[model samples]
Target: MNMPVLTSLRRRFAALAVLIASLPGAADAQADPAATFTALRAVDQRMATIAYRLTTANAPLCRGLVPVPGWAVHSLGQYDPAMRDQARTSFGFEAPIAVEAVVAGAPAARAGVVANDSILAVNGQPLRGAPGAKADSNARDAAQAVIARQPAAAALRVELVRGGARRTVAIAAPAGCPGSFEVLLGPGMDASADGSIVQIAVRFFERYTDDQVAVVVAHELAHNILRHRARLDAAKVSRGLLAEVGRNGRLFRQTETEADLLGMHLLRNAGYDPQLAVAFWRDHGGDVDGGLFRSRTHPSSKARAQAIADEIARIPAGSPRPYLPPLLATRDTPLQ
Candidate 1:
């Protein structure tokens, strides 16, 4: 449809969404009946904030080709935050991590991997053995090997679980040099013609702060696991949360939500405290561009936080944490 028709449709959805969320009384879900209305209004305000953050969070994670405004022109991955430091050495991997750049027009992009997707394990083998200063680069090398060994131009199947579903997708890659895979962490990121492979500019997960990096890596990993890039390609257009603003907005939001769900699973599977995903985003200090009644492509920051908490509650506690400090020994130890 044309511009006017699309605008009218979006307006219609906005109206319907309010009713569907039954949000007017959301304030009434307060601690007490007397404070119910007051609390509800607070909830409303917070929800509005969350909405803007959602869109901001999807920036670099979304298909790099989308022209949506970025939190920055480049979303570089650095261990700038304490959380990132904490996530390192926490995964208890017995091997070194291997990092790889995604090849443009290759299967990895089709798989939705950002520059930061931490290949903690390959074929169920951890990266502790890869060998390197960080030991993490081994995982990257291992991943390259996996790709190299695969039949060229063949459809490769990758498994990832998103939300409550395990999603699998096949990507036909250029054969021979898996080493040809190139990746950028921030603005350097690029997308392939078919939208399968992507070059990300950073690697936040490599920063290493236990649950913190787990959340970061898991989020990026989710993009590939959920086939978000492919989904974006399928969607001819989307406009941020106003998805009304651009043809690709709705697609952007949907891919983000899908990735969030899948990312949650990756974190859980990797043996990190899944709840930290929520905490990490809370501390992430996202951009809140939209004003009242404005929306984002991804779920509100509040929603992202809540969804993560919800997912964590459902995951059966998995293997024990591999790299945690001795709890009993350090419980009351002085902070050195």
Candidate 2:
């Protein structure tokens, strides 16, 4: 049985508050709670679908794995106190926890879980939450913990309350690369991975096509898969102001290059054109270069596009699924 990554799973669901508040129209959330909730759910669904495709496709290459149910859950208590009543009215949250989104064709969707289904219990254990708790994720995390403990590919019984009636369904969870995919509600056009989750700003979705956005997702996922955060820590690389100069700068650039190459392979594995990595840099590189892609720490956009092109050329035609690239060999080695 494939073990679940509980820590990552917990972190993913714990960010519900920020996720809800960051979406567009959230500024007027109190005025039109339904619009804000719908916006959040829509972004959640898109991110989940993209992540599922990449994580499941590249599971074999990842050292950490989790059983992805293809559904995200949220708690009414996780919203701001002032928004609780609106959330209740819009989402019909009769309980603390409820299904937030289900990716199309994912395990949860096949098992019959739908959006806003109130989660009553999992594996016969009832979900519990503190009374009158506002902006808390304790109950939501508890529910996720229960599900993450189950063996991968095993049938997990989930009790749901829909339309005032309760029914149980068994979700056969599938093993996938462990990490939550989320869209941070904001106007910034940036993406980051904290080892446990991949969060992209909402502006990317508003501006770019899904295919172009996947290029960014694959790059961030490559960082997690390569363990770049832990490796940089192990090497004692400085992340402060000095990070953009001297040895610190060189090491950071190395990680960026590795992520670029490996990210292309990830894109290919997921049936996305690796060339889009180059396209993304060509099309939007200037937009981010002044911000996150500062030359001191990252290659120039023109240089980045060229680098991806070179990597794509290196991959032999019709090789195999999960095409193992050269940089992956150094993943466990120390960064120098």
Candidate 3:
């Protein structure tokens, strides 16, 4: 994207204001999410074509052409750390299985799904390997196609093998929260005030453990350094103007990718092992249902993870760690 000369003028004034951020809201009451999403998506997709035609056909006439998310703005609304805790699973296991604990405050617990129940199926789909990596690509494709057809609250038929006997139960999935840790009877990392204070709730780190927790923190912190909220605001204004003028321009589709790259750089510089970002996603992001890039808020899980890997490779993998503390006074003396 071309940096506007005006942006340079604004940079000095925007610096003090640049450090804050906020939690973005959802679609307005008048807007239907499904339809609004569709229309907005169409404009984004055709941005380049519209801009090119306008500039080529008549450039001088369309000068003030940049109007961002006037009034309001939007981007890929990532439901990461928030939703990890609220996801649900149904069906009983057909055999004895090692229960991987349970998600707190979910339908499973409400429906009396005890740990080690050994789920067998969800409305007939077996839990032994349902809707996950265990299921092959074709199985995954077929499962997604079939499951999407079911209502959000459709009854889940659960079959389980417990104590060497078959049992049946029914459960339903529920709406999720913004961060995964909320469902775990605890708090999690949060970024707000437009990126000023990155609060982390790491009290019960066992469940998320090791690099997973660190990666989440690193990602949130990355948002601050990248000034994503402000950048997105600027991009939206410029793009929205292009859309309103009925022109197609090269859309800012790469913003999310750019954030991933720059965010990774910041995280690695802050001393986090970049490779652990990959493992963190693998642990929780295989079946993400959130947006990626302009289509959504954050980059796709694959892209974010890859960005981290790519960034780490640019530096010495095992370089000395960087510290965040303010530099100490040189006058302070050590025992000699």
Model 1 residue 28 CA deviation in Å: 57
Q: What would the TM-score be for candidate 2 when compared with the true structure?
A: 0.87
Ranking by TM-score: 2, 1, 3
TM-score of each: 0.36, 0.87, 0.31
lDDT of 2 by residue, 1-336 (tens): 001222332123244455445575456655655777788787778778888889889988887567888887877766666667767777778778888899899989999999989899887888878525435556776777776666666777899998899999998878888876766554456677767667777877777778888888888899999988889889998776788889898988888888888988999999998888998887787776563546577777887889999988888888898888878888889988
Judged by TM-score relative to the true structure, which candidate is superior, 2 or 3?
Answer: 2
Q: Model 3: runs farther than 4 Å from truth?
A: 1-193, 199-207, 237-255, 286-295, 316-336
Off by over 4 Å in 2: 1-31, 131-138, 291-295
Off by over 4 Å in 1: 1-147, 151-210, 239-248, 285-295, 316-336
Native-referenced Cα lDDT, model 2:
0.77
lDDT of 1 by residue, 229-263 (tens): 54454554543334645545555655565556556
Question: How many pairs collide in each candidate, listed in order?
Answer: 65, 1, 41
Deviation from native of the Cα of residue 22 in model 3, angstroms: 22
Ten contiguous residues minimizing lDDT sum, candidate 2? 1-10
